[model samples]
Target: MKPALKHFFDSMGAYFGRPGEESLEQLYAEHPGWDAQRGRVAVYGDFVRGHVRGVLEKIFPLVRGAVGPEAWSALVEGYTLTRPARHHELNHLAESFPAFVADAAASRGLAAFVPALARFEWTDFAVFASEERAPERVERLTANPTLAVLEHPFQLCAYVRTKGARAEPEAGEELALLWRHPELLVTYYVEATPSALLVLKMAVEGLAVPEVAAATGMPEAELRGAVERYSRDGLVLAPGGGHG
Candidate 1:
């Protein structure tokens, strides 16, 4: 494409989400062809914006629903203006939405619950789309290798699992474990206790069972049982010849 045409299209894409009268005037001034086609350009802008909104709705249904239509529309518009889609793949577009919402919440003086909910929704979305990897025998525990751990001030996992019906926000720390089930080919979430969280953290840090016990003051027998259960449940890969 010609440089002028390319710039016009790029600016048009951005305008779809954040249309300003000045921008429209500038666009027409630069590209006289668009002046005659202002109506068409407006329609196209709305079309593009609608497509983006649809994709975000699918990715963050719970959030969209919770915030209501008007607020959600404004949020999407503002997000598009500030954090415009940079990735070609739509799936990657909202990768930073949780943090974006968190920042927006702080700036707007919204409740703390908003960011927590955003994080939980993103966790579910990420877990569902994450690539499935075969467990490889590594010399040591480099990471959890399967699960994604999220800590929130509320029981966000339960809130999301129940579709925000039964679970209410509680004032305390909550740990969520999200992982894909190998056999079932589905993502699952579970609320984990602090002890389980510690063990998993230690494992991810490449600690041995004895080291984990010493660090956490957890009984060796209990640690062994936890490790065995995690291995069996596919939270971690089956034990290799290296450190547990």
Candidate 2:
């Protein structure tokens, strides 16, 4: 694309926020010969915003419900203005929405709970969409790619499970485990105990079973059982037929 055309599109992307009619008029004046019908531009802008909102709604329904429509719309609009979707796949657009919410909450003085809610929702979405692979044995486990662990001040997983009944932010360390079920073909979430969280962290860090056992001070047999259980449950990859 020519520099002029690139600039035009970038300028148009600004409309994804709250750009006024004057901005559109100015853009039309600056880029004459380009199709800039006000109605058409408005429709285009609505389409883009609607698409982005739909994706975010799917990924963060609880957040949307908690924030209400107006606030959610503003959040989405701000997100488009600041972090426009640059990926070829639209589904990947809201991958960073949780972080964006955190920043927005801080800057706007909105609810302190929104960020952790967003993170919990994004983790579920991410783990569901992540690619699945054959389980590898503990020693050969290089990466626990299919699972995600999120730590938050609010009990986000529990709150979400209760459909966001508790609106006020709670003060506590919450470890959320989002994973794809081994054979059910669906994603699931659970609150993790500290020991369970430690095991998962070790797995994600590519530690061997013995190494994990040593680090956690867990009995070797119990650690091996947990690893095997996760592998069978499809949360962890099966071991490859090789010594690590």
Candidate 3:
């Protein structure tokens, strides 16, 4: 908060946060003798940028693998310069990264799937970190509190599983159901069918099976079967006594 400290940080930001040739000159002009300390300032910038890239790499390993190292590094640097740290927690650094990737993918001429992949990866991390819990029982059908429905343009689940062995993903419009396991407290996902997604989306709004069937025009028997399957998989909170 002191003026001197604030000036130092601002100078550092100019060096790392801004691109082009004049950053160092601006830093040197701001504080005399910083020219002598350019090496130290460069090292400090590398250290901070390293931490940002490391956290993003951990959060979006799939995105990194898909884009390859050169593009990944450039993307990370772009993210660092554009989306400066806003949160106290390091993990929160990635909160805006998916949106960043969306813009970068377009301007940088990256693959179409890149944005979807980034979103999928971030959603996985978010579901893992969610504080919401599934109730033991539901009077009406209820979705898991941590459940997130993601509709992606590629087979993200399988693509992430392959770990980038495949150069590109299989292209298709798909729905993925991401949630934290109530008992294990780990994130899990399943590619879902349109009907199943519809049921779960309705259930998230507190619709009972019958109500969902009526609203969607699905047969009650079929809706009940789907509800039972979802309940067994912990996508829907089950009834107290049983899934009756």
How high is the CA lDDT of each candidate model? 0.69, 0.73, 0.79
- Candidates by lDDT, descending order: 3, 2, 1
What is candidate 3's lDDT per residue for 184-210, written digit by digit as tens? 777878889776676677676766777
Candidate 2, which ten residues in sequence have the lowest lDDT sum?
A: 134-143
Choose the strongest candidate by lDDT.
3
- Work out candidate 3's RMSD over C-alphas: 4.2
Q: How accurate is candidate 3 locally (lDDT)?
A: 0.79
lDDT of 1 by residue, 104-133 (tens): 886665557777787777777777777756
- C-alpha lDDT of residue 157 in model 3: 80
lDDT tens string, model 2, 1-244?
Answer: 9998788777776666655677667767777787757898877777777778788988888989888889888898788777456677788889888888988897766687788888888878778778865353445543345677788887676677788788765667887777876556567777776545555665667677777778768898987777666655555555553222
Q: Can you give the lDDT of residue 149 in candidate 3?
A: 84
Return the TM-score for each candidate structure.
0.72, 0.76, 0.77
Instruction: Specify the highest-TM-score model's number.
Output: 3
Ordered from best to worst TM-score, the candidate numbers read: 3, 2, 1
Q: List the residue pairs that clash in candidate 3.
A: none
Q: Clashes per prediction?
A: 0, 7, 0
